[model samples]
Target: MDWGQIFNSTAGWLFSPTTIAYALAATGLAVHFGYAGLLNFGMAGFMAIGAYGYAISILTFGLPWWAAMFVSILGAVVFALILGIPTLRLRADYLAIVTIAAAEIVRLLFTTQVFDEYTNSADGLSGYHQGFRDANPFPEGTYGFGPWTYNQNELWVRVFGVILLAIAVLAVWLLMRSPWGRVLKGIREDEDAVRALGKNVFSFKMQALIIGGIMGALGGVVFALPSAVVPATYTTSLTFFIWTILLLGGAATVFGPALGALIFWVIMAFLDNVLPAMAAVGWLPMTPIQAGTLRFILVGVALMLLVAFRPQGILGNKRELTFVK
Candidate 1:
């Protein structure tokens, strides 16, 4: 029940790599469901490919960090093509089914024993940090203030993540202001109308998928930077969490996803600390384990309320609500 410890833990998430990673992924989702109105539910699959692709390239192929990152992005592009080719034409619900299943397949393939040499199957891949860490330019020292303090390696990861997030935000902002972005939104609003205008709806959808998938892949790369590439991390729930973040922030807005990610993780971190402490202090009528589990229930309720009361999210334009359209 130490307030100081809880405060520090909560504050750390504000600048955590995981927060940046989720923010990136949510932005990708915003591209899919927000601007383009795609029903992609396999974002986790793209992230898995990025994380494992980077890890395998580094561990087995002896590639450097930048090369490995390229491989990961290429893998995401390939996955997007594969997933989008036959499925983009499907109805939204069908597309969702296909994507969720595809993501599970990707996760299980990594968990299977077939490619254990490269993926290490269930054990996942580790020891791939040397290349990334070696590229750190901060020199050996602790940095930052208060709960944000970290050693050189941690600082490097956070800095790189922030830079990547900024680049993504800028890229999305610019693209959305261009003609191509307008077409994407047009397709989202009325696919047949765009098609009647002689625009290739299918092509636009595919491009959006690939672009968003690449962003999701970048998110995976950032997520892998601070830890091993564990298959369990890319579950269907991860995609849903990304969706929640996307929806929580204003899906169609450029900065909404990042803002959503920051708020979501801060709340999660606060709950992770305060809930168990409350249980321990008999402030809650549940055991510590039950209290820990209750936080997720609360999150679910919060999401439901958000969806019901304000589906447009904090930064979203009410007219941009896909469900209403």
Candidate 2:
């Protein structure tokens, strides 16, 4: 059991690109399920669109990185409109069912051979990194120390992810403090009452869905920044992970989702390292393969416990989140 190696790996995830991406996505989830009381289960679909949109724009249209990102945002907006127009008025549970199914449909479409010319047909897309790499301001050198060390390009991706996350957090903070944010909260508490007050509940819900979807899109961009766009990466499990992060931090709080992402990944990283190490050292009664898979079981159990006992999450106010009717 190499404690040093485990610690180094765990520390690396402290500010990894993956953590930043999850933070951004979880913040969007907070906007949906936290402040707006929307049960959105299709965030994975938005992320898939963002990633593939950016990739296709670059590979097919020869668009610049920034422009490709913009196209991704537009794709998310269009997806939001398509998803929200007919579904926002449905009950929350129904919306969840529709969203989860819709996300699967999006994934399957990407996997299908119909768009193999662009999508690569489940082989996933790559070679889209050059445009983003060209924009890197970090010179060609190693940066940071210990587990945080990375080449210039890696550092650039982390910095870019952090900047996007910061902007998202700031934006959500400001919005949640405004009158519009208040209305979202009102609708979350009771949409019928807000509608009776002459507010367009559907419009507000649609707006929230769009905003949250944009956040999910940005998360996808950040995720694609450091790696290829793989269809398998944008499954329902990804949405569940984002939800876990949001719920772990605090649904309605501005910094909760980011905090949750950091903690969640750190824990996962720790388990990923320690579990296998324990099994290898004969400390655990399992093979390394089994130990590696046990982390997911542990995470599931932890989530169940959190929902049962601390549904408000680490930073959440119990009154701000209601898991039960």
Candidate 3:
């Protein structure tokens, strides 16, 4: 129960690759549900495609890092089109059902023995970050100050992740401010009205789906930068977690998802550290394992309360929220 260790561990997540990954994924979710009113519950599936795509390309084809990244984004686009073709015209609930099922299917496929040679099934893929690391500008030494130091490799990953996040945020902001962005908002508000005004509602929806899915896929690749590609990491819970971040930050706003991700991870890190320390010190009556579960329970209750009281979220405009009838 060392206070210094706990603080450092919790603070580490503030700039960690995982935080950047969640920020990117949440941003994509914001585009899907916030601006376009698309119920894409398979964000994790898109991420898996990106992760596996990048990993397979690196391990098998020995593609360059930039090339592998482009392929991963391309993979996301193709997956989005495949998922959106028949489902976008269906009801929102139908899209949700299809997406959730599709994500599970993708995860299981990656875990199966058939593609184990390429995917490594449960063992996943590793040692794919060599090319990425070789391009680092930082010298081989620890960087950062105080409790926030990182080795050259970790710092390189963080820098790459931040650059991608910045580009994504800028891209999203620009897109959401243009005429195309206006059409997307209009579709979210009232698709029939947009259609009557000569807008191709279906086409716009598909484009939005593809764009957001690609973002999620890119996020997946970033998420796996510091770690191996594990199929178990892309589960239904991952999508739900991203949704929570989107809702917490205020969907539809350009920076809301990123802010939400930062906050969510910070809170989780704090709880992960504080709860265990409290239990260990007898400040809580529960064992350490029970404390771990309790933290999630607290987070669940907090989410429920947030939805019940402020469904529009922290940075969301209530006027922008419209459920299609």
- lDDT score of model 2? 0.93
How many residue pairs clash in each candidate at the backbone level? 0, 0, 0
Expressed as tens digits, the lDDT of each residue in 3-114 for candidate 3 is 8988888889889889999899988888899999998899999999989999999999999988999999999988888888888998888889999999999999999999
* TM-scores, each model vs. reference: 0.99, 0.98, 0.97
lDDT of 1: 0.93
lDDT (tens digit, per residue) of candidate 1 on 1-325? 6999999999999989999999998888889999999989999999999999999999999999999999999999999999999999999999999999999999999999998988999999999999999999999999989999999999999999999899989989999999999999999999999999999999999999998998999999999999899998999989988998998999899999999999999999999899999999999999998999898899999999999988999899989866955
Candidate that beats the other on lDDT, 1 or 3, i.e. the better one: 1
Error of 1 at 111 (Å): 0.6
Sorting all predicted structures by TM-score, with the top scorer first, yields 1, 2, 3
Candidate 2 vs. true structure, TM-score: 0.98
Error of 3 at 314 (Å): 1.7
True-structure RMSD, every candidate: 0.7, 0.9, 1.4
Clashing pairs in 2: none
Residue 259 CA displacement from its true place in model 1, Å:
0.4
Model 3 alpha-carbon miss at residue 235, Å: 0.5
